[model samples]
Target: MEENNKIFDDEEEELYEHFSLDVDPGQTPMRLDKLLAIHLKKSSRNKIQNAIDSQSVRVNGQVVKSSYKPKPGDRIVVALPKPPREPTEILPENIPLNIVYEDEAVLIVNKDAQMVVHPGFANWDGTLVNALVYHFGQLPTSKNGAIRPGLVHRIDKGTSGLLVIAKTEYAMQHLARQFADHSTERTYYALIWGEPEQDKGTINAKLGRSQKDRRVTEVYEDGGYGREAITHYEVLKRMRYVSLVKCNLETGRTHQIRAHMKYIGHPLFGDATYGGDRILRGNMFSKYKQFVENCFQILPRQALHAKSLGFEHPEKKEWMQFDSELPEDMQTLLEKWEAYVQHV
Candidate 1:
């Protein structure tokens, strides 16, 4: 029972949730999972089923089965792994933002790889949240009132890219719906060791935290355990040992691209979490080793960048898209690889 209420680690906190809802007075009786599917657009049916199987779904504070018929006015609570942390008072910081586009409703900013998106355990300050609070006072918070405010989506600290910020409550709801429905377009570029067999392919797998290591997210191939994740990859450029590829995400699971790439035998270069730090393939000479080390120094973080994002304007109802260039580190890494692959 305690396992069902376990608190998520820092990373999982960004993507997971602890939600509570009161069944509408006019709500029709329905299977727990089926009812939840309507409310949880971001949650896959399999995930809700697994939550029910693990006794993580509760009705009026009592654990229930997936097939249980939810009655009107029943208070339902679901833990996607666990509950959120006690709220922390967010303090503003004068950190600068590279605002790409901004209006009354929304803003887009290109984030640096080193900055955590929001406050969490071990990361209270120097976050994008602090910057947001300083720049734009009093933004909308999540329904649960977790630390996140104004953020409709986030990227990993080690993965730099574009993120959309909601400036108004209505904008928040609008963008949130887009992400939950998988209607938002997000493409990431990554440098990975070894090229995938097919230039264009898709990775369909389930992702959940590894049992042996709670800090790491792992791919679960078999059903009944993890959330569905899909990443469509197209190789953009190939050197001898490494390749640059773009991944279009269908679902935004924690570490979806990193874990999926590792599962498919092509972990991103310099991704210390997924065994990409070590030389996984190609020339084994001592000179090659030194060259690899040099490349690692050029890009200390995972060689992944959020390259583009597309979404509909919440108020205007017009489609909008934004793109970003590779950061200096990733750009230099590729230039070095280009020389080395050509035997320079």
Candidate 2:
């Protein structure tokens, strides 16, 4: 027999879950972590071991190790703590969603611009997670019992594009493993400020958090501190000053495309975070400046979209892929640039 319950704090920062299990009379002795992993479908053996090391797991009111094995009739109690600052209570909102595809195991959503994918500090409400909770109700948790729900990957709040979410623990685990193994395919469309000298190229660099601004990521030339990131890009259309490009990602690091583009002096147009809002490549004429500003107004955020995503289905074991069209803002911005290039 097993009993489980969860408690949340007022600020939604910390979560505490208690699990009590009575050993079966016919059960053979097994490692505590392995047993806990079997009992908690959302938790992994490593997470169970961490709980045991944190003195959060006890057998018969005594702290135990990962190697501890339980006998029949033993009373086991486990206390699990979630990551700090993560919301404990995520309230569902009646926000509209552009659901592209959905099945019992997975869901593909065409996430709109200006939507936060998950709940975090300073962004607890009006997030995609809130809307998901409202529509779907009580999603499966992560390995550490955190309420990511069905999220397998995330796009930036300003970026619009396709996202695949897992609806079950098996799907979550399987998709997570695929992403970790770099087997999933992701492609993006970006409008960069300057035209690249080469039509197609690859930017291989290590990425890490910038010391100057902790909020953004930067490319590390020395490969000293950051993880490896690779982005392959090809010029789709050149408008003399700004060019539209397609980028394929080999590794999904934070700000990989934005940072890599900036490193090559071709940041995505209107990307205020990486010095792309200014007139980086156009002429000094006031008319050109006004045109650039107009384009900026049309497409305010970074002109990047997660255009496509491909992965293997967890349940069916079949390869699945999805694509999304560019949002209206991006389309209008591109049209303006094309007209300007043709007239000038």
Candidate 3:
């Protein structure tokens, strides 16, 4: 077995593995999928082929098809999404889903906060995948058939907002290409502690797992490590100590927005993992502390929401956009901030 180095991106909040391999100098040309199947022990040819069809396989830094024959000295890179949970008989559960749109090709859902997108670890049931399986019955799976039927992209468990699921194999391949190319449009709304110095700015940083804590993401200043992440933000409102901001992601790394905001010293309010749970801003007064605590109580999770998503239809080739209202908890928290600002 070839030695494989697996780097996990906790920010993406999913198990995606990136692999890089150099063809032997004397190796003969072979089909890319076959080469990957041989090199990737856990992956099957079907999975590698699906990744190629979705443009996730690259030769010499350019996306290639499975049919391409990799010559000796060629460098191959592939990215595969690993299902969070082990493959089991996923029985459909009658869970409530706020489905915004549905058709034979796709389904758009507005996931609620605190709900796991898929079953993983201790969360074995009552997930969005379980709900999808129950509602849609048998859905399309990736090549390996890991059981995340119909899911194309995912939002963090603490985030509430829109996601697109593909109903057919062709649709899945098409949607996957869009995400890999970074063509899909995604926007998020976040209530963060402390206002940014600028009204609108872009953060270009490299993100990798923190050496101190693997669960959290850290920004690299030298850009020598990790994946390149870009986030554009504009302040929507400022309530003295806290601010509401809109974030646009150029690259969908795990926890991109959360980590980037924290890197710039404006961690999202209530983001326990990134040190936003403590009072970062505001006065030392007991009343002020209590007010912040009350806000935290009202919004228990990270104050981030996937507010909008847009993409092209796989079959129709038409542009489609989805928008979701903030959940009651986030909205209520905003109201409290507004009220506090008015009173003060």
Candidate 4:
């Protein structure tokens, strides 16, 4: 065990750790999976082999097979998802989930606006993961002992929407690939301050953490920095002060919809991070301000909802899509805005 030195790197959010090991100078040539099995105590041989089959285990950045022999001085990395979660640190809590769809392979949840998807930092309990641990017995974890068991993707804590949690290792791998390839269909509904110039348009921008505010994401319109993010939006309805919009995600980068909408000068209604909290439109009359304030009181969080999600079934290999009705807060907010628009 002393000969096999593992390197740990930290990342933000639901990240799997890169289980990195430098092959010992005196290392004997053996199958890669076997070597990994020795280092990763919690994992079994079959799970290691499955990881190799999925092209997840790489040798010096090159994907390798289970049978591939690692020579001395070779850097072997089991590329699991980022910043691994310790299973022991997370305790199961009986938090209720609005499960939209569930089969042996996957669980589609309509996560609430206030709920954090997983436990982290200040939000160490009462998360979706805590609920998941309680709801199911032994959901499959990925190889390299990376333990965001079953969770493939996530919506923001304040953004209510659909999330697909994989139940099996195979399903996790399959669904993760779909998201990585940007093949999964994700559509969100947002009530934004200010209407778009056109009814429908595409926002092609690069997104990364803001230089000014590391906590929030920013849009890079010039495209020299950040990862590519595309959002196709259509105006569903336009009030004088705000517009109800539908957004389809082409690439699911962090804060893609939120950042892009803000970049285009129409931040999601009530979003404090990107400057939507103030009255972006409407008259200066106290009556209008009072109405907008009333609307804000109705929906306090960012006015964004993941309305629908679609992906191919991991085992069944058929297209599966899930949709949810807007949660009560957002629905009531829309009604309030509609009435205000009509009268004033």
Candidate 5:
């Protein structure tokens, strides 16, 4: 039957094939299934199981189980399967938010620090996505199959800033395309440890994951999973031991400002991960040391805020921009820091 043939063709195309095997001298052999997956870029344990079940994989001209191990000279073949398709899950929640701007196609919200954009391990609820799902039924899915829905771009969990969320598929596509073209205007304010000699400059670096610690990113010289990141910054104000800086993002990379600032010897105040020791040390008060030590508190959180966002509306074809003033906590922190300088 033509339908049966079509199904078989699809299955055959889905299966991986002609995987290579290389074993070290005087070493025990590893499983053929593992080798095949590594070689053919085919992942997912279920897909491997399905391939083994259909007898589409061969180990040295012999059909083998999924657990079969291969020797150094053994030739391996695997049938790669077409990736399975799954519907996107968009759950709703009634989380609090500070919405700055909203139109039919797009929304700009002042994303508070410490809130994730979507769900993951250890953070299933209280995300921006959860709030959006509660407000809107669903989000536009991306062609690249990113897990988070409605998010065109992202700021870090600890970075408070204006974020754009899409309301429709058409808007999502257009906005994503605009971000890809580097037309969106994004700027932030941060308090850093020291002042740079130049008022305006750019930090161009390649970033990648750290091999020693997968959780942290590092500036890689040889380009390991790394991408080019550019951050333009200007000194807004210079204090006795700290400086206020404004940053413009040319390329949006994870921890771009934090990492790049640290790389340039001006880590953000209250940014423990990227070196806020200067802020903590500079503000050392012997009388308050015991209290701060007991509480394990430092600069509340890096004094970073998303000041402005600019973009073209997806449906209206109108240029739009929104701004958010500093929250009370940040304003208070700045006030204390400025007073400390005035006394000296």
Candidate 6:
């Protein structure tokens, strides 16, 4: 039994990963760098491309050009250097990042839904790192020696869309000060579960950490480590149950959008924890309840996306603005609701 087990382990170690390569006859001669990026998960396109440019990659026993074409049965050999454990930031992930614009000092990255901006306890990998590491050069780190040196402002774990990050320490400090002074203009698009009786309103409430549940913040009336929170909202489109509204933050607070929306009796769609029961019960929007329920089942949380951001470049003394469109999932839900309303 011991001998069999040893033999099994030996076979697994000796097994070479094998993959077949196929190229179309008419397709212009593709580069070796492109081939490797498409083939290997352990390696990225930029790394392989750099190696080829530096004359490090070999094909069929010869140093070849990046655009070298391979004949049928050609043996391609890549002399890949050992990649660093922690590489520098790279391009915005093709992971559907909605980039508004970019400049030398900073880049506006429109974050996707359900993406954690920086590394934390629950998420170590498969994050923006997997994208930034492959896209840009290594960013400058703080004295603390942690990665993600460019990151300046951070949205919530589940919130989506335009958030700014500093490309340099000077830029980072300046942007941080902007947030401190409440000069940055941030706007969010939310599909709430209820229609506000008024077309526009403000939620002025003091928010503090809930003593019973430290994880959440609540509208504290008494003794609590609270801060002044204010949110202004305007209805863009209205349905029987759900209303699409644009929310502006007067002050940045934890869960400001979720909490303020709920306080106004218009919790965001699919928000289960923060008073989204109206949408969940599938009773309010009776005509499109089935569609809304299907959307809720597909979505992990509330329907909120950061649609626009405008702020001054602290260093450059220039105004910068960014905008992101609603994602397809949310768009589909809106379409269904609109169609249902039209039919009625």
Q: TM-score: which candidate is best?
A: 1
Could you give candidate 6's per-residue lDDT for residues 1-344 as a string of tens digits?
Answer: 00011111212343222322444444455566666676656765655665566554555556788777665555554443332234333334544455566666777887777887766556655566445555555554444455775776677766778888676777877887888788889999888876788998988887865545545767855523368998999999987767889999989888888887777677788776686744532355555566666777656677888888888896779888777888777787787777766766
lDDT of 3 at 48: 67
The TM-score-based order of candidates, best leading, equals: 1, 3, 2, 4, 5, 6
lDDT, candidate 2, 69-140, per-residue tens: 999889887755563578778888999999999999999999988999998867888988899889999677
Off by over 4 Å in 4: 1-88, 142-146
lDDT of 3 by residue, 118-189 (tens): 877788888999998988887888776577898878888899999999999999999989998999999999
TM-score of each: 0.78, 0.76, 0.76, 0.75, 0.73, 0.66
Better of 2 and 6 by TM-score: 2
- The sequence of per-residue lDDT tens digits that candidate 4 reaches over residues 176-219 is 99999999999999999987899999998888776555568987
lDDT, candidate 6, at 216 = 73
RMSD of 4: 10.5
- List, residue by residue over 4-68, the lDDT tens digit for candidate 5: 11232323554444343435355366676675565556456545654666676666657898788
Indicate the residue-level lDDT of 332 in model 4. Answer: 96
Where is model 3 more than 4 Å wrong at Cα?
Answer: 1-85
- What is the lDDT for 276 in model 5? 74
Question: On lDDT, who's better, 3 or 5?
Answer: 3
Q: What is the Cα-based lDDT of residue 77 in candidate 6? A: 47
What C-alpha lDDT, on a 0 to 100 scale, does residue 286 get in candidate 6? Answer: 54
Q: Per-residue lDDT tens digits of candidate 1, residues 196-269?
A: 88989999999997766556889877766778899999999999699999999999998999999999999999
Clashes of 3: 3
TM-score of model 1 (CA atoms): 0.78
Model 3 residue 220 distance off true place after TM-score fit, in angstroms: 2.0
The global C-alpha lDDT for each of the candidates, from Candidate 1 onward, is 0.87, 0.87, 0.86, 0.84, 0.72, 0.68
